[model samples]
Target: MHYCQSCETPVAMEPRNGHAVCPECGRADDVAAPGPLFVVTGASGSGKTAVLAGLARRLQGRCVTFDADLLMDAAGALSGSRPIDWPAFRDAWLAVAHGVAQSGMPTVLLGPFIPTHLQELPARRWIGDIHFIVLDCPDELRRARINARPPWRSRDIEEQVEFGQWLRRNIADRVDTSSELQKTPRRPSPHGSTAI
Candidate 1:
């Protein structure tokens, strides 16, 4: 058994591509370093997925996009008061993000994430740079969007909306999506402006 240098967790010593790999985190000692990561965070109705889809199209061939929800196993959390298994979610997200970054492509991650979530990832040490952007939409507009997609739990929507408000007040980079709802999805500039 070997211990991962990054996570300090015991891992099976599996050799792959002439390097010892960590089974749990898929960390290889000899792999090329990863590229910078740009994380786009927003609440449920804040248009995170749409924004990321547009970004992926605009940055085609130069970047890859991943939805954090797909990396997480939230079934347990959904039935409880908490909505995520922070440790498990963090580990899974880091593994995939690190692997994608190692391929030399910038990664765009979309999810309901806060800055603190990024800090908990084990891959933080290896990542080159991280750019965080929070998508914002007005409460009324957000509620309308959520309502249109019926069958959603009221409590969940309220929680997400509250989080979105908190993000707008605290996060440095925020892009308002209220206007985007009226027009086509455009590329967002690095400085947090929606480009035409």
Candidate 2:
């Protein structure tokens, strides 16, 4: 069974115009194939950046790693307030991912992304197997971590902690980094299907 690169749903073996089309999203698998795209997402101060950095160091030159915030900042898509411009952020991110994929490298994207934010990405049609991994921590620990950062905003930290709790409850693959750090990042299997 082949999975849709866009929505990660299992598509029938039947091919359309030489490509397996995702029935749910109507995205052709070939067009959406950007190798393997792993999104490591979590709330603010969730240790995602640290985890990705460790993974990159372990992988040596095998993969490409990028932070979504830096990408957004470079594109001027992020603001200092609530309600982000998702469409613009998605576009800019996809452009960078596409470039990385075109270079024949797997991508590890670290960011603060809810499930819905990923589902609504316009460039999903051109993305390959998208794996989502959410890092979680206790509220107190998260608060402490956020507070340790310079120029921290209390409101933003509170919001992030709340969202982190919600994400730990809602997301399927969650790693609790409160006590121990994950030494290695695992590559997602090509098997199984899920609705976007």
Candidate 3:
């Protein structure tokens, strides 16, 4: 198992190319708000979805959240047979998230966030504070979650094996997702005033 430089998650070394994509969270790592981005990246069973769901509830109005899949349709449009003007979609959404971040709001982006393909976000001009988060869990537990997924929903075991290894190697700051899945890693929220 090796860790991905971009996502920082342990994954298996085989079949590692066709899918550099993370099953837990996607390109939210590209967010560059200078402030905490309230990220949630991890392996499928790492409790990424569960943690984010809780985080969203915990931070209700203080955060503006978006799932990585929120732009999947638009991303797909970029390769449409007719090329459905996806550049416009990309620019639009990027601008929206950046705008929201700029509004002094603590924002959370949770989903299958991959960091490699997507460039770092919000252009140099949009700089602010930035922090990162990655959730973690034991391999057996991860496999169980994958298995619990509906017949059509879960990723193949082989694929998850590779990804699981990858995530283990990459993550440094992690919150283990056991039954308690302790909120042991409560991050300093990006909202509120900064000391001058």
Candidate 4:
């Protein structure tokens, strides 16, 4: 039997409307399909890139990193010389990520975004339940990691650290990356239900 890609609840042979409704949360799993998308957002040097890289390697899937900056570049006019459009950038990020999830591959998105980016998406798109993994840690430690990175790495660790802290405070259920926190969540139940 087929199943909901997001939560794994069994689905009828002909699931309605190309959408998979999760029997557990009453939430639509993925409107399109499953790609095991994991979004890891954090200030630079929060170890998100490293952690996601490790996860990608371990999973044996080609790690795809979708930086919204690319979208900004695609729309250089709106993105401007600074590459900062919080609202538009966030919208684009959610769209690309949701599509990636539908592609049925493993994906890891690293960015600096607030929780509302996902929380505010339209539920009908069934864009909800995209695994959000926030990377957080003491600002100082994060700063150190950033400084240790190659010259190409971000140098404004303080600003990013501030943002990360703000997100960590505002968002509920962020797995702390300060130390060695597990990245992957336990698998959902057979019927596509989350215990939480």
C-alpha TM-score for every candidate: 0.70, 0.67, 0.58, 0.55
In model 1, the runs with Cα more than 4 Å from the true position are: 1-28, 72-84, 152-155, 182-196
Global lDDT scores for all candidate models: 0.67, 0.65, 0.51, 0.56
- Candidate 4: Cα lDDT at 136: 77
In the range 15-109, model 2's lDDT, one tens digit per residue, is 35436576778776553235667788888767775576577787668878876756544444345655556676766676567557766777888
Residue-wise C-alpha lDDT for candidate 1, range 90-113, written one tens digit per residue: 556656666786677878888777
Clashes of each: 0, 0, 30, 4
True lDDT of residue 176, candidate 2: 84
Strongest candidate by TM-score: 1
Question: What TM-score would candidate 1 get against the native?
Answer: 0.70
Model 4, position 31: C-alpha lDDT score: 57
Clashes of 2: 0
Candidate ordering by TM-score (highest first)? 1, 2, 3, 4
lDDT of each residue in 1-196, candidate 4, tens digit only: 2345545555433224556555654555435553445566776655554464466556565646654344544555665577555665566665565576566655566666655665664421434445666777887777766665555334776677778788787766576676673343322122221100
lDDT, residue 182, candidate 3: 39
Cα lDDT tens digits, model 3, 1-196, are 1124445665322212222233444322233343335555665656655565577788788987765546656555565776444334433444555557656676676543434312443231242343445666677766766676555454666566567567567755667677665344433222221110
Best by lDDT: 1
Task: Give the clash count for model 4.
Answer: 4
Q: Which stretches of candidate 3 lie over 4 Å from their true place?
A: 1-36, 81-94, 114-127, 181-196
What lDDT does candidate 3 reach at residue 126?
42
* lDDT assessment of candidate 2: 0.65
Evaluate residue 97 in candidate 3 and report its C-alpha lDDT on the 0 to 100 scale: 52
